[model samples]
Target: MKILVFCGFIFFLAIFPLSGAGFELKTVIDQVSRQVVVPAAPQRVIALAPSITEIIFALEQENRLKGVTAYSDFPKKALKLPKVGSYVYLDLERIVSLKPDLCIAIKDGNPKEAVDKLESIGIPVYAVNPKNIETVINTVVEIGGLLNASKKADALAKNMRHRIKRVEALIAKTDLRPGIFFQIGIAPIVSVGTDTFIHELIIKAGGRNLAEGPVSYPRFSREQVLALAPDIIIITSMARSVVFEQVKAEWNKWPNMPAVKTGRIFLEDSNLFDRPTPRLVDGLELLLKLIHPELINEANKCL
Candidate 1:
């Protein structure tokens, strides 16, 4: 997972740029309350973050996407798009070369300087900041509105809400909240805190996050983790699959650990957990299944 931290969500409207041949220039506010002028029907757009690219693709607005940041390799087609560098370290020259009429950025990941520089050079940048599942759905809808795909965005948002409610309803039926140790970093042995998306998912999926605190992604020693005695250990890393298996094997050595004893240590796709996209709902359901296998049938029904 790309570690792009987030805050609360914001709502904004679309505006038309007057200079673009047939388009009119109009000012609109972004998620961060920054005023941007863009074309009403932007033909060339750039996604400054992988998650933003995913959202635009989900909205079926990829036709306007002229460029995307590195690792925006979802939907298969994004692989063919021009790269403007990663979200954190943006390539201003490459981005400017693309001649994009609009650029969608994530407030958390995309560097502020890059955004300001783009705006200064007459490139309209719309930003989004989605901190949790609910806001992520809102972001989908908001991006849809920005791209003239409100109908699709609304439908997608509705579907996301439906799935989230299903998880909530199913979770309400159980008092079984497993103590979970979610490891995101394998080298230094790090876990999510209460403020992170994974921690929120854990709680919503009926698992108690053992690493909940103020420090966001916190590091821990093996002894410290064992002392916590988590019921389930879920490891999500950007590392290769073999590395995950090796980590699992290492955890298996601790037979006394409940998760190892019960063969509950699992490896998951980090993107589903970290990316602030519609796929997070998918991650939530997966967490539900892992935390409570007994609810598999009911969870399927909920889906």
Candidate 2:
């Protein structure tokens, strides 16, 4: 689906033709939903998702950023940016008031109605779907091409790929794959199923996900989780330490569980594991180390 465009303006500066950086940029295609044009040197940009904001900052295009959705605070400077709304639902009026030339979004996170409304208003919205680890990697490259920062994007994508490969190499040398339970939500005991980025990363990080439900995020009962017999339990919560610890303590009641008996439960930074950004690599490294303590030293190398 790669189309060649005139990169006459970008060709001479930091030329990265492979990532489609130069005088030309390609249209963003999202699951047959919409095609968006990337304006050359877009003046005002609005990021509708945290991950999109991180990508823009990674490419050092924060200056072009005029507005962002709630919780788009990765690069310290972003905190000062104006907020249009949360990724869950945007303040259309506020976003339009920003007068951005381009608005970035996530197909899964942003409401289609909102994106369509923005498009109708003549503001270009480029939405990407990072459904899996591979698509997450591709996002960095694609975003870089759109911002004319192909070189930086290529390097970032290469680094993530290299780190992921390192984990895979370590996993290949191991025969024992631990069964892991990733607890994301406390109420109703929610966890990621096979249809999620976390699930894919768990498999790639040399572990088996115990919660294999139908949806991306599935609700599990206490008895159901106990039957799974997970070897390890990992918690990812954006809540305060007190709240997160309390959530972990809830699992403590099941002392007979293999994970509880072995004290294999771990608390991870929610920002790393929860976000579909470059930090997913960080999350994967930690996951690998937790699953195989023997790879603790090897995990550092991947990061």
Candidate 3:
């Protein structure tokens, strides 16, 4: 099955961007390992995860991307890059062959040994661990510092934070928030919980997530779903038509369900909510529209 979250549940632990720029020289700290001095502006970079790759593009540093893993298909041009491997397994040989000066890998999406191996070979590696929206925003700014593009990165981060506050304000105005259930997987139904970014998105979008347990992605029985009585049901598309159809069919079986009756069902892009990139704002905006149908026009204008 094509699960939405990466194998790590979150990105790997290390990503430290220290300030010291002049003639391509700066010391970077990793969340888990030793510090490494990177060239001020690394021209050849390898992105170990799709989220990292997305950040590189968001910073307008795509020209420096030497390699990326599979499923880094958003920008259209990324599909043409050399494939290092997937989020869990990376081809060490291919990555080494590319001779990347700097490697960016997620804490959870990448294996520690791979990152260690990259460093063993004298390749400067920066690991990132963005657990929440604030860290995600800070990480973007950190990346800018690492690449000597702090200004651009800060500008982007500022814009994102501004929009997020706007969304929060929008949610605050309405006293009635809908009970929401977001479906990520089918056949024993997997959904995000309190520990995941998706859960945070739901809250920020003004919807109360019914899956409130500590488990990042919890499984729910059909009976439990009925018990929760979600006013709205949202299904995520993982580029798979079969799973989506199944989710829709399963929910439709209960015509009396609040979500089914009210026609508040929605299908959203997995990338927008899954990846911790600038696109998260897009996800938030979309969710506001889905959860509160009345604010569709206002949400459209806010963005």
Candidate 4:
């Protein structure tokens, strides 16, 4: 009877571990979309988007980045990393050679087939799509969690929230809200409308978007733009040649426009404005300065 009891106790110990299982930790899901699962703390990470690379660097996980895309120009050190081609077209051979455990990509930037191929080869991929400022913060936190830098990510997110609140407070003190028109791409004349990250930024920067009614990025007619009569016109210098001289000359022809008459046309770095990362705080501060230079004190001029 003593031997049987001892055997039963051993059996119970073995089954207890399996039954309780210590409650397996739940994998975090990407908030933008529930489909993607954050991989367990990646060691060798490849950032397919410049924005993702910036976020990783902000989280101080630059050492973990095995490879980065061609356009990641920030931090200067990122330039030394091996290039994985452009966001739209990746160098599959180079990526496979690097043997990265995980690849971080943007939703629209990376191709579906490339992601599938990487997954088939036993590499995990986390595709992030941050449509607005709030989502951008969440993406950073998620990336941090995936990289085992949860504390850093939380701190970064908190800092960004505080900066945004400061900007909001400044805007609320004044009733002056300028009507803004943001130019995304010229030539065909693409502009940020409602439901765009840029549109949200404009609102946060204490400016009202002139391009409304249309949801996503839409091409505007010259006549339609004239009708909006924006108080301030902001153009992104994303293109190789920011042709500010040419743009100013063209706007000069439209004498009736408020922006043209008042010379409220300003140029901003497209990468900083368009990329949804921690640097976006810089862009917001710049936007505020441009929109209401009067609110900025003499000491804040350096900003």
Candidate 5:
């Protein structure tokens, strides 16, 4: 009986560690499907999006970042990191060579096949989808928790929330709300509708999106745009040398449009406005300044 009991005890001991091995679980957003992501925290991390890279830096996990996408230019130091190619077209071989324990990617920007390939090769991938400013804050906190930087993430999230709340409070007190049209891309005449982060920013910045007919980004006819009669037109400042004067010259062709007639067209930093990151507040402040110039001083106070 003693011998049998001793064998059983040994077996129990053999399995005990396996049974109780602690594994951290983290919730994130899957950019492709635009859903919540819950994955194990990765140690050797590679970020596939510039916005994600910014969030990682904000979380102070720069040392953990092994690789970043080609376009991650902010923080200046990120430019020195290993390039994993663009999110849309990643260099799989380079990524594989990096031997990252875990990879972070935007589900929309990073192909699902690439994520699957990495997983097949025994690498973990966390997909992030921050669709709005609030979601951006939550994503930061979640990523921080996953990366063992929960305290910093919490602090960042709190600060972001406070800033957003302050904006909301100020907007609530004002009776004036401008109708805004956000141009996503110009050549094809793409505009953000209700389903995009930019759309959320428009609302947060105390403006109503005039591109309400479409649920997502859509290319509309110039006549349709003119009919919308937006009070303000916000062109994303992309490409080298944003020429508001050139844009205004084009808008002048549509003499009857409110945005054109009132000369409420403005250009905003595309990186800040389009990328869902901590700097979105800066984009909001910019919009607020354009909509209500008087509030610039107060917005600066909130910042």
Candidate 6:
């Protein structure tokens, strides 16, 4: 199996000199609460998740990124970097071949075995777990600290906080919480629940998530969705425009549904809604516009 070969290669590397031996070392607690000994100034770093790649780029520390996992296609320039495979299925051999001084990982997406194997081979792997918008901002600051770009990180966090407060200020004007059904999966009719970033965005953007529950992502039947009578329906997709149009057409069949009657169904970029990056603030703003267009329109008139 590929996993077996990867483990064997890791074992082979473990007997050699530690990779970060000559560097200045510092002990710090990662976001996952694990104490890791990392280089005082890591020069060659590998980002284990797309979100991590975006964060590094946002902090203007992309020069230090030696590698990134696949699908880190944001910022356009990241497409030129070497890939260490997908976040869920990491290519440990390729990662080791990059000769990185550090590896930044995501606790939610990166496989635990891969982290353990990389650490076992004496590679410092600092992991971050950003569960919400606030933690995501903290993640930016923490990663900035690691990369020695603290000032940029602080400025970025301040900007995000300021934008969030502006949204809150506008939302305070109205108590209307439109019922929203956000579709992420087309075939299965999947929607996010309370624990997900999408749910938090929906709630914070002054929309009520009809799928709010214990389940992270819940599937819906056509009848069930019809029963919810959502005021707005937003679909997140990376598919072709035709596919989205087709999906929209399917939803448009129910004339009696509130969303269908008002023509409030919309399609959104999946990355903005799902990724835990600085752009999540953009997602929140987008949601607010869709959910409370009246408020935004009114605010614009005052300008």
Per TM-score, the best of the predicted structures is 6
RMSD vs true structure, all candidates: 6.9, 8.9, 7.3, 11.0, 9.7, 1.9
Instruction: Decide which is better by TM-score, 1 or 3.
Output: 1
- Give the better candidate number (1 or 5) by TM-score: 1
Q: Compute each candidate's TM-score over C-alphas.
A: 0.91, 0.86, 0.88, 0.84, 0.81, 0.95
178 Cα displacement, candidate 6 (Å): 0.5
Q: Which segments of candidate 3 are over 4 A away from where they belong?
A: 1-24, 31-34, 240-242, 298-303
Candidate with the larger lDDT of 5 and 6: 6
Residue pairs clashing in model 3 are: 11-107, 11-108, 12-106, 12-107, 12-108, 13-107, 14-31, 14-127, 24-40, 25-40
**CA lDDT, every model vs. true structure:** 0.85, 0.80, 0.82, 0.79, 0.76, 0.93
lDDT tens digits, residue span 1-303, model 4: 654654454454445522123322234555435454334556678999999999999999999999999989888888999998999999876776676767888886789898876655555677898887888999999888888899999999999999999888888877888999898767767788788777778888888888864668889877788888988999886553557767767777899999988999887788777888988888888988888777777437657
Which parts of model 5 have CA positions greater than 4 angstroms off?
1-43, 240-243, 254-256, 297-303
Clashing pairs in 2: 7-23, 7-24, 10-22, 10-23
The sequence of per-residue lDDT tens digits that candidate 6 reaches over residues 1-303 is 777876776776677634556889999999989999998899999999999999999999999999999999898999999999999999888898787889999999999999998898889999999999999999999999999999999999999999999999999999999999999999989999999999999988999999999999999999999999999999988885977899989998889999999999999898998899999999999999999999999999999
How far residue 290's Cα lies from its native spot in candidate 6, in Å, is: 0.6
lDDT of each residue in 238-295, candidate 3, tens digit only? 7567776777787899998999998777787889998988888889988988887677
Which residue pairs show collisions in model 1? 16-24, 16-26, 16-40, 17-24, 17-25, 17-38, 17-39, 18-24, 18-25
> What ordering of candidates by lDDT runs from best to worst?
6, 1, 3, 2, 4, 5
Clashing pairs in 5: 28-37, 32-107
Model 4 — which ten-residue stretch has the worst lDDT? 17-26
Ranked by TM-score, top first: 6, 1, 3, 2, 4, 5
Q: How many times do residue backbones clash in model 6?
A: 0
lDDT of 3 at 124: 76
